[model samples]
Target: MEKIARQGLLYDFYGALLTEHQRHVYEDVVFYDLSLSEIAEEQGISRQGVHDLIKRCNKILESYEEKLHLVEKFEQTKKLAREIQSLTKAFSENRDMGLIHRIEEISGEIVELEAH
Candidate 1:
């Protein structure tokens, strides 16, 4: 994944765990696309301080993902759900038994994922 996109996903999955101060600074940098100097000026902190905080926030978010695997499971489940939707549509259009089987298989996979 691209760096920005990866960061966004990590933030989405783990951002709520951050302290309010960390969330404000990290959101300014990641979500608002503010430069470190800009965030520093606005927050009345040093530029280096903003940079370090952002880095620490990123590390913390990544550690949460590494331990919990929620982000990974979410992505996988999303992909499987899309596939199931596509299979359902195809089955509806063609009334194909093969499509039905595929949809069932995908549903089973989704169930298995949720169980974990």
Candidate 2:
């Protein structure tokens, strides 16, 4: 995944791990689209220092995702949720018991996947 995407997912799950300054610098540079020089000027740090801090923040975010696998799990959960939604729509529109039953089965599978 891209650094920003990875950081977003990690932040959703574990943002409290970062220090306040790290959080501010990271959010400004990565999410707010502030230029490195601008971020350095705003934060009273050298541009190189800002660049390095952002790098370190990226590493920290990536490390959490790698260790916890939250991003992967969330992706899987999202796919399963979509499947369930589709099946629910099919069940409502078509009234196919077999399809509904299949959806139920898949829902069971999703629950089982979540349990681990």
Candidate 3:
């Protein structure tokens, strides 16, 4: 993934674990696309401080992902859902038993993933 998109995913998955102050700064940089200097000026901190804070936030969020794997599971589930949708559409269009069987299998896999 691209750096910005990866950061956004990390933030989405683990942002709630951050302190209010950390979230504010991280949102400014990642969501609002603010420069480090801009965030520092607005928040009354040094530019280096803002940079370091962002780095620390990244590390913390990544640590959460490493331990929990929620993001990985979410991505896998989403991909499976998309595949199921496509299989359903194909079955509908062609009345194909094979496509229906694939859709059923994918749905079962999605259910099993969620059960865990």
Candidate 4:
């Protein structure tokens, strides 16, 4: 995955674990696309401080992902869901028996993932 997109996914899955100030700074940096200097100006802190906070927040978010794997599971499930959608669309268009079997297989995989 791209760096920015990976950061967003990590944040989405683990952001709630961050302290309030960390969360604020992180949201500005990642979600709002604010530069360090810009965030520092808004928060009345030094640019280096903002930069350090962002780095720390990124570390914390990544640590959570390493332990939990929520983002990984979500991406896998999303891919499977999209595949099922595509297969279903094809089946609808041409009534292909093969597509139906593939759709069922993928749906079973989804169910197994949910069990975990």
lDDT of each: 0.93, 0.84, 0.93, 0.90
Clashing pairs in 1: none
Question: How well does candidate 2 match the true structure in TM-score terms?
Answer: 0.87
- What lDDT is reached at residue 34 by model 2? 92
Report residue 83 deviation for candidate 2 (angstroms). 0.9
Best-matching candidate per TM-score: 3
Ranking by TM-score: 3, 4, 1, 2
lDDT of 4 by residue, 55-115 (tens): 8988988889889888999999999999998988888899989998898899999999988
Q: Write the residue-wise lDDT of candidate 2 on 31-71 in tens digits.
A: 78899989999999999999999888778877887898877
TM-score, candidate 3, is: 0.96
Model 4 off-target regions past 4 Å? none
Q: In model 1, which regions exceed 4 Å deviation?
A: none
How far does residue 113 in candidate 2 sit from its true spot (Å)?
A: 2.4
Give the per-residue lDDT digits (tens) of candidate 3, residues 1-116. Answer: 88889899999989999999999999999999999989999999999999999999999999999999998999999999999888888877899898888888998999999889
Q: For model 2, what is the alpha-carbon lDDT of residue 115? A: 92
Q: What would the TM-scores of all predictions be? A: 0.94, 0.87, 0.96, 0.94
Better of 2 and 3 by TM-score: 3
